[model samples]
Target chain A: MFFDEFKSWQKELTHYSFEQVSQGDVERALGHERLDFMDFLALLSPAAKLYLEPMAQKAHRLTLQNFGKSILLFTPLYLANFCSNQCVYCSYNIKNKILRRKLSLAEVEVEGKAIAEKGLQHLLLLTGESRQASSPEYIADCTRILRPYFASLGIEVYPLETQEYRELYAAGIDTLTIYQEVYDEDIYASVHLAGPKRIHRYRLEAPERACEAGFSGVTIGALLGLGEWRKEAFFTGLHASYLQKTYPDVEIVVSAPRMRPHAGSYKPQYPITDAELVQILLAYRLFMPRGGITLSTRESAPMRDALLPLGITKLSAGSLTSVGGYAESTETGSAQFEVSDERSVEEVVAMLRSKGYQPVFCDWVNLRDRRGA
Target chain B: MQQVNCELLNDPFEIGGQKLRSRLFTGTGKFSSHELVPQIIEASGTQVVTMALRRLDWRNPQENILNYIPKGITLLPNTSGARTAEEAIRIARLAKAAGCGNWIKIEVIQDQRYLLPDNPETLIAAEQLVKEGFVVLPYMSPDLGTARRLESVGAAAVMPLGAPIGSNRGLQTRELIRILIEEISLPIIVDAGIGRPSEAAEALEMGAAAVLVNTAIATADQPLEMAHAFRLAVEAGRSAYLAGLGARRDQAEASSPLTGFLREE
Candidate 1:
């Protein structure tokens, strides 16, 4: 599998010290019209920090050339907060004493209607890593219920087998988002202890399975604060590159979400600063100019706004990370992470216009209804 | 002496049940503004325009791309992201459902380096989509055999690339395209790798039914003017082809009388 390939690249990345990434490497990377894996590594190094301005400009140009001046807008609708894992970082970890809630099918409809009212045609359904509450059948049911309301539906749930992904795809789900959390197996195992999520290989291969199951899009990411940011970024790039080469038609999105504040008192062992995050995103853009890079509400509104022109092609607006939060005013369950951008969907759209970008809501049409039509 | 005028350039062609007056088709991508697209289309006198399907904006679901396109213009929705026949068929159905009409551009490309369309997948999609009541125009590399297959599958037209898409390297496969134009019975519309108006003219001059240009016009400093230039070029090339361009000679064939020249005497 690609796990071995990924580990080999990871091992190769470890041999190069930070200082070895010289100014010459940065300039050479910037000068090339098409970037390679080495160019990506060079851009992620500390030496590339001095050339951020040129890198940002080139990334902006490349983004415009590939995706146009449009940002794909989606909002996450957290379906359930139930958990089976004792992850050190997340708020919904079973070890935490936070309240848990799972929405019924009726409640999901209400939430879907609420999101529809926001003028959003694309939605991401999220849940904690619990097979019992958020089983494949349950997720497929949710997809069926929400399929009528949204033109595009994505899920960020526990990794499933190839057949399970095919089942979800047939149920009107078009996208699957799975974060490896950290590429380093040791750090991943230490954080996600005693659960199905602890298996690194399963999660690492989930996106490929989704692609093989006929998903139009697959997103992979790493929580930045878990291990060395540069190493994590390299592995993320490698993984995304491999997937892109394998599934040439699939839209592969790479996101580097920084660890946010949750109910659990767990903090980032090696927190990635804002500047470092920007550098990492720029590296990704330089590496895969045609690939999609996503920015979520986990970052502050100001940071997200500033980074729009840099490389981000997708943005999540007006997100709520708690079960049943979209339907009712009551916060019945603890949020997985606090949303830093509290702006409404309208405000986000207005902001995008002010920056000369179009906020796209529905980028896909569901053709599975052809038989009914 | 009698007055003479060019009259052989009045021929019209039909694709997907739409009779097009102009031999030029335009695309809606890479434009600086959506509002400018209609103007460029009008200036170019193109009757068919192509666009892609993506998710609609949640904030303004009614702000559709169809609104910008003027009425009476045939909209050609392309299946650009589909790598397989199943995905292409799904997109074609969805595009028809979205009211983009039945004309579908089958572009099943899995190769990333050159962005070449997959011939087998495109053939599969064209057959299925044609059976499903669609006007399928399959894009393929300039391969005569694939062009024949697409035609046998009831493709309305065959769009063979002059070169790699967006490369602006004009007509690298001119000989192969010439072979397609000779062998294929359907309208051979030269698509992609046309960077300038002259290249578009060259394609038409070689007996192409039409030429579809996007990046050449859209990325120009003045898209409107570029569209105008392409319009004139297409017209000129069609006229030249109709007038019967003189055959090439290995040796010099002087227009003037060589034996009666005073200097030669």
Candidate 2:
């Protein structure tokens, strides 16, 4: 499991200072012939700031060579906003005065058809972290309903047991996306005031459980502004690398979601700059050439467009972050976060084409993962 | 045995009911720009071009990769990232469903360090694809047993790697491939790791039916020129094989009796 790898690295990096990382180490990492973890660390170091241009160049070439000039696009459909946890940085915090809503089964079919009409073949279903509000059977039913419309289905809901994940896979969910809101235990505990999301270890191992349950793909990340930026990025890389190396066949994607404005006014403790996010993304591409790098809709349109050449393979386009957001329903759930890139799916497709990128809707057929769908 | 003639050398190279004019097969990966793709295909004179299935976007027909490849080229859509037989079969079905040709290259790579093709999964995939009326060419390690099995399962051709894919190592498994050539009834198309024109020539001269050159041509500084060079080398090597290479001997067989003149024996 990644927990052992995560704990050991977390303890070891405690005494090690980023200031000690020299320019020479960063250069050696840049010039390394094959990708390795040590080289990734050097690239992520502070001294690598001067080598960002070279790192970006290498990352671009590597990404193009491994994955062609195609950017996969998938939109998130926020199923429900009801949460048992009090994640202070999120808009879905129960303490916040937000209109929490869950889509009925008929509304789900409507939303699925609405997205399907836009020619999207892949859909990511997301929900708040509350079993009482959204149970496993409820999510599975949603998966079954969405299966007929989309060629593939992914989930970003609360973590579940291996059996639950297996049941979802059988129900047409082949991919799992989970973000351990923060990696630092102390900061994690402070932010997640209540509920099962407080268990950081379980959240971290959710991707592993999904893998063990035979999911074909897993996207794992850490919300950037919650803790020390560099350490969180490193832990996220280590976590992703562990899963990648263990499940070589499974598609591993790394996403770096920055803190966007939400319902609550929670300021970031360690706000990372835009250039730092680029460095993190480039380092990820260099480390795992085959593993995917996804750019979320939390960033501005210009920011996402500018970072495309620096090793981004997956993108979220025309995303609606509220429950029943796509359908013409009177009851609209509050958004988990504000949308920064409001370009419609057509605009996103045109932008990708103008930038010489073919926007892909479905990557995997996922025939093995789906049984009776 | 009868002597090889020019007419025999000019005979059609047919595999799975398709007659290929060029013995060199090119790929669309590793190129810096898609604009260079047509040039490389033209320079290489390849009739079949391989590409990954994940690179295509069926929804956006205008930005399709098919636009980049010129007409009359057979596309060999590969299952590059598929890890199991089911995944490979699914990709094949999707390709067929999308109106892409039925020709499929089954690559089931399990290891990341070497990118070694898993022979078991490949056989499973090939068997199912062939049954489904799709022409299947499975990339595999050059083993006589596996080659024979592939032939028995109606594989169009058995593509054995010369070395690890994209390693630029060149013909590390020549002896094994030579055995496959001698034993298997199917065509022995050497794929991957022939990084230079001379290595491609060597593969053909050793009796490989055709050579698939991708990285050696795509990654070259003068990719088009390299493609032309590989085309000429593959043609020369195929001609040399038809003309028959000379047998080898440990001791030197002096031409013009140089030993008698120098040693005064």
Candidate 3:
């Protein structure tokens, strides 16, 4: 007999006891002296789009009120590109005959030192799914080796076990970013055809496991164009809310990444407009004012600049989207995706300074120092 | 005529599971050097100091200042910049994780220019934190009504501002503070707007359980001398209040009450 699934989308959607909010609620929350979580939902509603200017103003005021005249800057270094999964939309898919490379320990050290020399403190480690080459042990070893070199070190790689996260924690890995790609299970399963990435449930459970393993922060997001943007947006906020409440100590960051042009032959079926992306970002901020909202290099300079003070708190400047691109950008042959902002680190810092933002080059928190052992 | 047997302040004034003896609370911002900060704070006799949350400066040898303060002084991490309840909640969580003490000075001020306390936001944050088992001492405007409401919500103390924070304008609401003294039974710490020894003395005289003066002492040309002056002023005020101040007469009166008593025979 074929296994009949008892749970369905309808059941899962219905089971969500989220406090539903309307546009009016958002207006009330913004107008009121105190904003609650429900008010966050109201601000993100379709009706709240008309009030974008005011919302942006309120977000700016709050940002200044909380963070003061400062903007934190960090850069992501794509360490390796060796995948086992057939991710249809990704540039680093195993099926894609593009040059695949993995950074050696020395190479990672070289890139890390190069980035660190640029007065960069916060470093994000990126890689594709390659259990053999980029295993948890390898990542942990890299993290341990790179701990003293940077102030804050985070990872964006394949999901691992909770015990694996504990091992990484021991290795001084401070933060983890595991994008669900799409929260819709069917879309996720369809998009990821082979390898451990095919398991939709496991990827969804990775952040939770990482949190359980005592990670300081867990960032959640869905690729904007992969599934129904509205549904994905709602679920992304819901998931962040869940993690925030469940792990109050864990800093929650919500990143909105749309499918940008890449070397992959495939393209997005549903494209997200820049306006819609801004709306989604606004909604996320209105929903969770305290949560960290990040803007990556996937966006154009104008968009990144316009959105910096509005709600986005973190930015990745002069990011390299290919393995070993830091030491030698040309050696990578091709980048995973074309960078919308092509400004160099120095240029970016100068621009940020001219714009009245204190472009920080280093991570503020030392993961190694945080570890008692 | 008398040699005063002055008593140095006590520590750990028994609130919740801890005792906070030194009532003076200081902040790290507006200071020129971190090295001089510990010295100034130590000289101020502040057993508990407040610090705001900031992104870690990973490159600095001493990124976290919490580690630098004298180990005995309790660190009361504050949500000074939060404009709303949610932001305050977020800062509080980060502070707890950073091990800056569970006691949070919940300050949710929306107006950056004025730095006025948003009472509604503060109450909301206090309610949530107190529920979450945090010792909340919210910095509020000196509105007696608000202080009473805050005390009812399990606030360890109601920190009513003598004036807008960092103003150094001194206590501008003496009448209202007198009312607050008459009203709430909780520890009424006069926080902010206290610029000099006289203001500190006045707050103590008004029956404020404690007074938190930062800018007046920290920014003084002679921080140590100013700190000592404030100590004496607080002591004088407390003693005066305890010894029973003479009643003020609205109208001129005879040496004795003319209406109620006959002339001494």
Candidate 4:
């Protein structure tokens, strides 16, 4: 349903001359209490780069006002690196000659315990898109095993049917995060050459389906380096706003992750510098003041720390992108992508404290299982 | 300035088995600094303060919000993000486990525009939380029927909004709140939208059991002074209510005899 809406906006967005987004547009967007999609585009334009300082200040104040001086900390547990997709940017692309592995139920528990021992209660389970290895049934089983150890469980796997999402929710999953990778359908098709991920419309509608299945929260994002950063950011903002309006009960989180080096030797066609990334994050904060904005370990330590006060409400700490990496200490299998910030969970926590932020671990409780208790 | 020499107001009240001296309840949101909370509570003489439930910090587990709160003040953990009864119940259980005791402010609001509390969902949450042994104080829109339902569901108190949350519009639903104050047997604590001290005093004068003030004080230039002002206002209003207001008349009544003035003679 939203695909049509997105297409119409996309067509209109392409026609707007980027030079027309003047300083006046930026100033007007900043003055309004509520920002619209056009305001977002204006903020993302090059003309608005001069107003970065003021934008950052507003973002900082708004974040502090809404979320307080707290950062929600979660670690992604790479459940498996197996895949059937042929995405150009990822290391786990099926055509690449790499080691493939998926953790057994026992291994999942071991990794879960390892993270729990660090006093973390929120976890995001990641896996490559492969039905044979990382199927919905298998993912739900992993959720069942780790539900007791973690307070909140999120999944970032392949897209699924509405009924499948419902099954995962019944198995103790609290959130579903599905990034479109890139919003431009043409760019998306070129990158994801072969796989179910090539179906752009299906992936675009995953979050809505997840909401239909009754997820408490859903996170969406776009990889910044693949397409034009401005266009990608605009579409990402549009998508998040739509989901936010459609499902008021669900928490819609948006992330702007930069492309990282992986097995596939593909460089970004439209690279986003650190400054541009900062502008994008600030635009997201100004547009959706109450929505959750996340920053992953894909960014460098200094970069993540600098952007923390700007608008980031969630961060992944001590993340490993490989399956069974946490339990064994050594690299057990292929990683989806190389992690930039290799700090331990403790180090990240200490960094948060040094920055005067309180790292939050367990923000949600599972009531579905304890309905009568 | 002329001093009124008003009598000291000392009407103690009880909610959820806790005896409270101050009828003013404060919140731990929108403050420029958390350190200001203790000072404000002390200045206002408020015995109850509310905080929302969020994720615990893993790095510094020892550094807790409860540390900032004084020993005797009652900590009310609000279910601010919950949109359904199940979610509220979950947050309440987790809050109790986090050592906040059993007090919970059920705020089930799904509307993002005005942030109005959802009455039906709030009523459901209050019923469930009460059954789960929580001291449930549900925030709701000022509707007589919903207030009666919350009371029937065993809510410890019914907190009806004076206006939409954080609006600072002050008693836009005054007539409905008056009806609730008149009919509901439970304590009618006016929860949100009271921006000024005079508004808090007005709610008290209208027979509200207590008033919860957050944005008015927290967003002020001097929170401590504002807290002190609210304390005095609540006391004055409660005293006036207890002392009983004079009946209204259709026409002006003279304090001195109209026929015995020296100028007239």
TM-score of chain A of 2: 0.98
Worst 10 residues of 3 chain B by lDDT: B256-265
> Estimated TM-score per prediction?
0.61, 0.61, 0.56, 0.61
**Regions of candidate 1 where Cα sits further than 4 Å from its true position:** A329-331, A370-373, B1-265
Each candidate's fnat, listed in order, reads 0.00, 0.00, 0.00, 0.00
lDDT of 2 by residue, B35-145 (tens): 999999999999999988775455775455678998889999999999898999998898888877899999998888899999999999999999999999999999877
lDDT (CA) for every model shown?
0.87, 0.86, 0.76, 0.87
Tell me which residue pairs clash in candidate 2.
none
Q: Which is superior by TM-score, 3 or 4?
A: 4
> Which digits, one per residue and each the tens of the lDDT, describe model 2 over residues A257-338?
9999999988989998887888888888887777899899999998888888888989999998887778775368899988
Put down candidate 4 lDDT per residue, B1-265, tens digits, no spaces: 9654444455777788877778999998998876888898999989999999777688877555677899978999999998887898899999999889899999988998889899999988888888889998999999888887898889889999998888889999999898788667788999999999999999998889999999999999899999999999998788876755543321232333211211221
Candidate 2 docking: what grade?
Answer: incorrect
What clash pairs does model 4 have?
none
DockQ of each: 0.01, 0.01, 0.01, 0.01
lDDT for B168 (candidate 3): 94
Question: Which stretches in model 2 have alpha-carbon errors above 4 Å?
Answer: A368-373, B1-265
lDDT of 1 by residue, A147-206 (tens): 888898999999999999999899989999999999998999888877778889999999
